[model samples]
Target: MARRPRLEPRETRLDATQAYLGRAADLAAEFAAGIPPRRIRTFSEAAPDDLRTALAILSEIPDLGLVVHGPRGCAVRAPGVAPLAVTDLDQRDTVLGSGEVLAETVRALDAAYAVTAIAVLGSPVIAINSDDIRATVATLGLELDKPVVWVRTEGFRSAVPATGGDAAADALLQLVDAEETEREPGLLNLLTSTRGPELAALARQIEGLGWQVNILPAGASVADIARAGRAEASLVLAPDLLDLFAEGLETRFGVTRLDVALPLGAQATTAVLRRVAALGGAAAPPAPPRSVSKPLAGRRIALALPTSWGLATAELIGDLGGDVAALSVPHLDRSHAAALASLAERWPDLQIHVGEGQGFERTGFLRRNALDLLLGASDAVAGALRQGLPAAVLDPARLIGAGAAEAVTAAVDSAFARLALARSAAQNARPGYTPGWLKRSPDWHIKQEVR
Candidate 1:
C-alpha cells in the first residue's frame, strides 16, 4: 500500500487560494491548448476580485478574446474592468424570457466582431435556462456562421473560467468538419482536445522517432482534421474528445482509432513511442538505461479525478510496480458506477473512497497521505505541500492522452520526473517545515516548546 502522509490541519486561507488558482491557471491553459481557438462571452456572479483574477487569466490567451456579461442584472462598469460592450437584461425581461434580448446581443456581436464561434458561458442565468440561449440563437438566426459550444459551470467561481476555455476549444473543434480539403499523407493530425507543454514534450518525444504530428485543438486546422483519414492511424487521447472525433473520422473518412491509456511512466512512454514507430513503420530507439532499472519499483500511488477519466491511472501506477492503495471516485453517477465497480473488483486491494455530496474527496485524502506519487489537481499537490510532502500533479486540464497509454504515459512521466526533482529540492531546503496552525497560534508553539 502507498504510505499516506501524516495528518495535519488545513493550511492558511491564502495558501489555499494560491494553490487553487495555480491549478486553475494550468487547467485554463489546457482548455486554451486543447479546445478549438475562438472568442468567449462570459456571465458571472462572482465578486470583483475573483472576476479580476479570472479576467487576468483570460486576457493571457492570445488566440481567445473575452466579452464579460454583467451580474445581478446590473448595468454598470464592473470595477477593475476596462470599457467593453455589455448586454443587460432587466428583471421583467429575464422573467418574461430574454430570448429576444440574448438574440439581439449575439446578432450585434456577429455583425460587429469577427467571431468565428460562440459559447454561452455557463452560469446560474444560463444554466437555469441554457435552452433559452440556444433556442434564442437558433430562432433569431444568430449562429455567427460558426459552431456554438455549451459548457456547464453552474455555481462555480474558479471552474467557470477554465470551463469557458474548454467550451471555446470544443466549439472550435466542432467547426473542423465544416472545412473541406485534403491533407498530405505522412502529415498525421493529432486527435487530442489539447496538447499542453508537457503533452507537447510527449509529441516531441514521438517526433524524435521520425513522425510528423499536427496536434488538434492546438496547431491543427479543420482541413487537417477532416483529412485525418489519410493518416495511417489516429491516437485517441482523452476518451471523451477522442470518441467524438474518432466517430466522425470513421463515419466520414475511414480512420482507425487506437484506444489506449494516457501514458505517465517510463514503461508507459516507451510503449507509446513503440506504437508510433510501428505505425510509421520505423524502429524504436533502444530503451533508456534507467527504464530497465527499478526506479519506480514498489512505489505506491493513488489518484482521484472526475469519473470521466478511467481507472487507467490505477493500472498504469500498478504496472510500474506500485500499489494502487485506494481508488476514490467522486460523482460516480449511475452512468459511471458500473465501470468503477469493475475496476475496484479487479484491484481489490485498492481502497474505494467516495466523497460526500457527489464530489470526490478521495483526491484530498490522497494528497494528505503524501504518497510516493500523487496524481490529482494542483490543489492536491498544494495540500500535500502544506503538510511538507511533495506530490506530482496529474492535471487533466494540462495533460491528455493523445494516442492512449503510451502517448499519455510519456507526457505524464516527463512531468512526474520534473516534479520529483522539485520535491527533492524542497525536502533538502527545509528540514523543519512547520504546519500553518502552529504559526497562526503562537500560544500552541510556546506550550509545545515548554513541554
Candidate 2:
C-alpha cells in the first residue's frame, strides 16, 4: 500500500473535542466583538539583562516618568533617555526584603519621581521569594498613597536572555491597570503569549475597533492602565499571560476577558477583528484582505521557535494563510503538549517537528524545507535564510498595541517581501541569524533578535 502524503489544514478546523467550552466560546466571541485593551508595565529585580531591557523600553518614554526602587546598582544607564529618578535599594536590603528599606526607597522615589506609578524589579538577595514580594510593594503603595505594581521574573543568563521586556510588560499590566482602569466603551487588550515584533500589527487591529489602547510597559504609562476601569473591555492575544491576567483582572475589577489563540494568519486575524468589534457593541469592520482570515486559499509555512511559541505561532500561521512545515520547540514539557495537541488535531497532515535541544537536526530540517516563512529562534531563522528562505524575527515590544499594528503589519509584510527582493542579501549576509546564546528558549525567541 502507498503511504499518504502530508496534509495541511484547509484553513483551520479543530476536532469537536478541541472546540472551546460555553464560557470559553462566549469570551472568545466577545473578544472578537471588540473590547478595551489595557496598558501594562513591569516591576522586578534589577538583573543586568532586566536592567538593559528596562532601559531600552523606558528610554522610549518621551518623558521618563517612572519611579524605581532598589540600591544605587538598581539604576542602569539609559542613553539619550533619562530624566527619571531611581531609588537605590542598597546592599543589605538587596538580599533581605526589608519593609523599612522599601518604605524608605518608595518615599524617596515618590518624592523624586513624583510620577504616574511605581513597579519593582528583582535584585541582590531578594530574588528568593520574589514571587510574593509584590504584596510587600502593595503595602508600601498603600502607605505612600501611590499606585505601584511589582513584577517578579527570574534573571536570564547571557547564554539565553529571557524575554524580560515581555514578562516585565505583563507585570506592568497587572500593576497599574488592574485597579484604576475601567473598561473603555469599546476596545480590547491584545494580550500576547509570545513576545515578538508582530505585536505591532495586532495592536493596530485593535485600534481599528475605535477603542483606545494602552500597551502596558511598552507603550503605556501609569495613567493609562489606571484608565482601564473606564475602557469597554479586555482581550487576551497570548495564552501564557492570558489566564494569569484574565483571572486576576476579572476578580479584581469585574472586567471580562475574551481568551483566544494568538491571531496570526489572515483568517485568524479577521475572526479576531470580528470578535473585537462585537465586544465593542459595533458591527465588525470590513477586515482588510491581509487580515488573518481572508485571501488565504491554501498556503504552507513553518513554525520554528522554542516550545513556548510552537502552538501560538502555528495558530497565527494557520489563521493567516499557511500550513506548518516544521515545529521546533526547545522542550517537550506540559506547556508544549497542549499547544502541540491543538495544532496536531487541527492539521493532522502537517509535520510537527519537536526539537528537544538537538539544534543541528532541527536546523537542518528547516534549511531543507525552507518553508514559506520561519517563526522561531533567530538561529533557526538564520538556518532557513541560509537556504535562501524568507524569515522575520518576532518582537514583543512591537506587540504593545497603542495603535502600532499597522506599522507592525507593514513591517512583517515588508520583511517577507524583502526576503524575495534580497534573498541573496539574507543568504550571504546571514543578517537574521542570532546566536544560540542570545535566543530565549521557547518564550523569548521573538524579541531576542532586538537584544
Candidate 3:
C-alpha cells in the first residue's frame, strides 16, 4: 500500500556533476567517454533548494492542495508561491513528531478547499525528523476517499533546484491510471512546465497540424492526468524539468516519450515539429526564413541559463550575429550529453561554468572575459548588473518556438541600449564582493570532490 517511486536528488539519481569551470571540448570529451566530472565549491553564494521546486510543479496541477509540512518559516515562501496549507510545525510538534500535525493539516485543507488530491510534502524539519509521509498520506486517502500522495522533498536535498521537479514527477505519476483507458487516435500529450501565452501558441502550432493536444502536469485536471496514458506520445519542451514526467509516462503506461530538442530557435522549432508530426504520418511544414536584423552584430555574449534554455537560446544568439563567448549553466548531467557534444563540436574552446548561483565565480568570470553582454534569468542578470556588466533579462517563457531569435535580440539590444545605466551602476553600485576575491580566478574556491 505504501509503494512509492524512489525520489532521489539529481546528484545521486542523474549523476549530475558540478563543473565549477571547464571548456566545452574537455567536458564533452569526458562525458563522451562515460565520465562525469564532479567539483566542489569551497564557498557557495546561493542555490535554490529542492522544496520550492517541488512546490512550483505540484501547485500547477488544478485542484491539487500542497501540504507543505514544515515550520511557519517554511510556509512563508507562500507569498509568491502557490496556495499551500502548511503543517505549521511548532517547537512542540517538531520535538515530538509532525505526523499528527500533517494529517490534521491535510484533513483541514480537504475540508476548507476544493482539492481532488492532497499531497503531503516533506520539509527539512520533517526530513530530519524522519516522518512517515507515505503512511500518513495512505491513511488519509482512505479516510477522506481522495487521491492523497506524498511528495518526498527536503529543503536541503539538492542544490540543483530542478531535482525537485523529479520528486514532483514521481508523485504525479501515482495519480495517473491509464492502463484500462482506450487509447485516443492521434492524441499527443503536449507536456510542459509553462502555462503562459507561449504555451498556448505552442499548443496551437501543434493543433494546427491536426493532432489532439493534451497539456499535462501544468494546468491539467486530475481527469486529464488520468487519461494521459491514452495518448500516442508525450512531447516534452524542456527536458531538464519535464523529461522525467514523460519517461514516467513511458514506463507506466507505454506512452511514447519523444526526446526532442526544445523549440527555442527557428531551426529547433522546425525539428521539434517534424519529429512530433511524423508520429501521426504527417509531414511538418518548414519554418519560414527569419529576417535577421543582427542586432548583436559581432558582439561576444555570455549567457547564464538552464540546460535547455542555454543550449537552444545559444542558437538564437548566433542567429542574431552574436558570438556565444561562454555558457553558464546551473547543473550538468547525462541529459545534457548530446547538446554538450554538439556545442563542443562547434565551439570547442568555449568556456563552460556549471554551478548554482555562485555570484563570486560569476564576478570573476565576467571580469576576466571580454564579453559585450550578459543575459540570464532575473537572479543571474541582477548579479551581473550589480557587478556593472551589461546584462539583460532572459525570460525563458518568451524565448520558446519561432520567436526565439526576436525575443533574444530584443533583450540583447536593450542591454546594449542601456549601456549608460550599466556604466553609471559600475561607478556607483556596490561590487558586493571584496576586490581581493574578485581578483582571484572564478574557480579558485572550487576543489574537485574525491569520489
Give me the candidate number with maximum TM-score. 3
* TM-score between candidate 3 and the true structure: 0.94
Over the stretch 132-250, how does candidate 1's per-residue lDDT look in tens digits? 44454344433455544332222333322222333333333444554444544555555654446767878787777776776664444434543465654567564432344555565
Better of 2 and 3 by TM-score: 3
lDDT agreement of model 3 with the native: 0.79
Extract clashing residue pairs from model 3: none
Q: Which order, best to worst by lDDT?
A: 3, 2, 1
Off by over 4 Å in 3: 2-5, 78-82, 287-295
Q: With candidate 3 superimposed using the best TM-score fit, by how many Å does residue 67's alpha carbon deviate from the native?
A: 0.7
Lowest lDDT block of 10, candidate 2: 10-19
lDDT of each: 0.44, 0.48, 0.79
Clashes of each: 17, 87, 0
Most lDDT-accurate candidate: 3
Off by over 4 Å in 2: 1-114, 128-144, 154-217, 284-301, 305-323, 329-339, 345-451
Q: What is the lDDT of residue 212 in candidate 2?
A: 64
